[model samples]
Target: MASSLTKDSATPAPEKTFLGHPIGLATLFMTEMWERFSYYGMRALLVLYLVSGGADAATGSQGGGLGYTAAISTAIYSVYVALVYLMAMPGGWFGDRVWGARKTVAIAGSVIMVGHVALALPGQISFFVGLLLVAAGSGLLKANISTMVGHLYKGVDDPRRDSGFTLFYIGINVGAFAAPLVIGTIGETVNWHIGFLLAAVGMGIGLLVFLLAGRTLDPKSSQVPNPLTPAERKAVIVKGLAVAAVVAVFYTAVTMAGMFTIKWALYPITIAGLIIPVAVLVRIKRDKDLTPGEQGKMSAYIWFFVAAAVFWMIYDQGGSTLSLFGDKNSERSLFGWEVPTVIFQSLNPLFVVALAPIFATVWVLLARRNREPSTIVKFSVALAIVGASFFVFAIPLSQTAGNDTKVTMWWLVLIFLMHTVAELCLSPVGLSVTTKMAPQKYSSQMMGVWFLAVTAGDCITGLLGLAEVKMNGVGVILFQAAAAALAGLAIYMYRKKVDALVEGTK
Candidate 1:
């Protein structure tokens, strides 16, 4: 797959630009940084806003929450997160099959901004509408953006590729780290609507940065990696639109009929999430066009994706369940200042920022001696780390008398550190390998499929929120930790088989 690129954008970049990576890194780095700030900032406020209606009646809520029960709020969170990942499939397909990644990203960013703006408005209609837009837009932007990062590197085996992704991940954290400090504080202390407005402004800035700097990225990023014929393009577009329209109508009818609420929306969302990747896998496995090696790579890729999703299912709680824990259970005051609970959401990104470079360097060093862990092995490590974090977090539960009792900050801090280590082991590796393993013709689409791991996990997370474990009790935490650990270990035990399946990729 080659890009139809402009000459100016394709000019040979200096080898040592942007801390020894391509010049394009600066462009994507800033864009992703601000986008993440917008995302995490808004996410930090969601559950809090949902649950705040029950906050101290005397003092009143900063913006008065939606007054939902924990289960309902968490269900909404799970669905939104799941949709964001699930939508990326078509978003990736659109980029690969129709509009170029550059255009897809720009359009998606604009749509996301619209979502944020709508969220700034009060009322349930605007709220759900806003979440829908943001999820759809994010789906389009994310996989394509990550794909563009891979395009900047020289080749599949490029030594700097992992490092570049790590740096990009760092850019993600820069925004994530600051969002809580800025957006979290204001949203918690002042007004929820104001906080949402700030998120919109942040995305607007991100879009502007992307337009200005992204132009300097490899021109190949602007062209479809695999160009389609006129007939193919028309067929895909028409079918996509028709299918989307029908689904939208059916969904709306169900909702307006009172047979559906935001909570029940998960049924469709989860079905879509599972179906997209499975369909893609079927396509890959059955495609006569692919060589045997390509088929093996796809199988291995699926295993890694499943493991990554398991890790994410645990890691994602940072925003949903762990968030409420920080707000209600963890001690919020630091040196006499009342800390906004949202600030705790910053911990994982903060750890990623501090640790990513070290991990990148370690991988580079290990690769020199052929000592680096295979992608699958790293995934196992990630699962163990996150599972352990939960177990550690759960240990203190026996001491607390009530859900609101304050636990020490180190308990949460330790968990973030553990989760961050798990993330480092998995996130950058997954991003780098997806581009490497995908068949060239379907590269972008495959990247989107890979995100189905998150899609599956998020769907399950929503359902899990409705379960007894929504807020971690001793039983819930222990079971979750054990399940993830066992899953990781099971994968690790099959490392030899998984490695053989991906030999062509390596």
Candidate 2:
């Protein structure tokens, strides 16, 4: 008799625990982990290094900065992040139509390595070119890897699906946690170029792993299931070109971020980028009927995106405002050894490693009791925890005198601990939600869309970090608190509608 689970029969059955946890799953996990390490390692230092000039001295306040000004750095960071996710949508499309996931991932990895190498170069032009390359590679690679993971499981309901993704999720954080200590320390304390070079090395490892595994795993692993005919391919190419042209024109007009200008033009463009997808989702519901079951699943995805944006906005402060906070405002000595402000970036991932299993167990127990919170509820909690952590900065803000006050290292630890709890509630589950909810035919595209929320949130964090520099430490703390509150309220209010949408589809 056939097994009750459809996934059991979805493909040629493999023995249990192929290479310790299903061959396909293991491969994707390793690849993503290394990629995240490179990405997060850079992120861990980007804001701190920029705002503080360098990471050596404990210059906590705006007074201690390198002098380029926070506004300029924030603008550069925002544009870089925005472009990163923006590239992903097309990257996914390219993989689906022409190259397939494995090849696309390899190509993207190679490109990213080159970008990191460029960042290691010592010129403004190289910096710009490196960032551009990194963004392009991220766009191309991020979505495809997750889609490949889903393909490994064969069907959405596979019993191994959750565990497979869980393992993969762990990989993401492992790299994130390690980057700060390894790359951040070297870059800030020793040489900035060292960190960039390390990032390139991480990408190289990821590329090698993916290339080797692609050949040994499923024969159909990289095959495009649906090939477009000439006319259809032509139409897609035209649409892509048109979108690129329009976005390029829009970018050109508002491209004054380098000059520290946040123009009105960005508002409409950002809005449209978000709204167009919602419009497509609505159309899918109204015209396509898209099964209430499927609609509900996808609504969960939208909620995940919003909630994640909130969580990341706060979580990402580690590299931006928080780094500055640690530098000038907080006390940083431990057993006669002074800690580099950028090194604090390691806390969240460190906490993740320590706390992930606890949260996972709570979830499993809750699932057993049939009392698990909906994805939306968990996300709300994540936002609340993330937002609440900023209040801790307020204490230091009041105590410090632009670098005179010595705040305890424990305070930074406390804030990261809270953010860690919040992340545990959000990040891993968010990845799973996206993978499960999106249609198989559009898996990577939807994942790309989901990542756009992260990109947007990172941009917001940079903007707010700059605002903190301008308005003073207290102003930054209050701004973050307000954003978190707003995001939490929005999620709670919309919970029912979103829950219904997910339920109807499921």
Give a tens-digit lDDT track for model 1, residues 1-506. Answer: 24546765788875648988888888888888888898889999988887777642113346466877666677678778888888887788778877888889899999999999998899878987898999899888986888789889878799989779878877888899999999888988899888988999999999998998875788888898667899987887799899999988998898789887655565666666667767877887788888888888887888888888788787888887777776666666789987778888888877877887799789989989998888888988999988998889887675663544567766877888899999899987897789789876676466676778887777677777655244557777788899899989999999999999989343
lDDT of each: 0.81, 0.72
Q: List residue ranges in candidate 1 displaced over 4 A.
A: 1-25, 54-63, 147-167, 212-218, 224-241, 248-257, 364-371, 401-404, 439-441, 466-469, 504-506
lDDT leader: 1
Residue 77 accuracy (lDDT) in model 1: 85
The lDDT of model 2 is 0.72
Name every residue pair that clashes in candidate 1.
none
| lDDT of each residue in 1-506, candidate 2, tens digit only | 45656766687855746445567676777888888888877776666555554433344332223344555455456656766776887787777778887788889999999999998887666876887899889888975887777677668777778778767777887888788888888777777778889999998998889888775455565787566789998998899899999878767766655542443433443454455555645554454546666765665666667677767766766665566667666667879987876678778777888888888788889989988888778888888888888877677677774546667878888888888898888877776677667865565456666777766676665554335355235776778777886788788888888877766321
Q: Which stretches of candidate 2 lie over 4 Å from their true place?
A: 1-19, 23-26, 52-67, 154-159, 235-305, 401-403, 432-445, 462-472, 493-501, 504-506
TM values, all candidates: 0.87, 0.81
Cα TM-score of candidate 2:
0.81
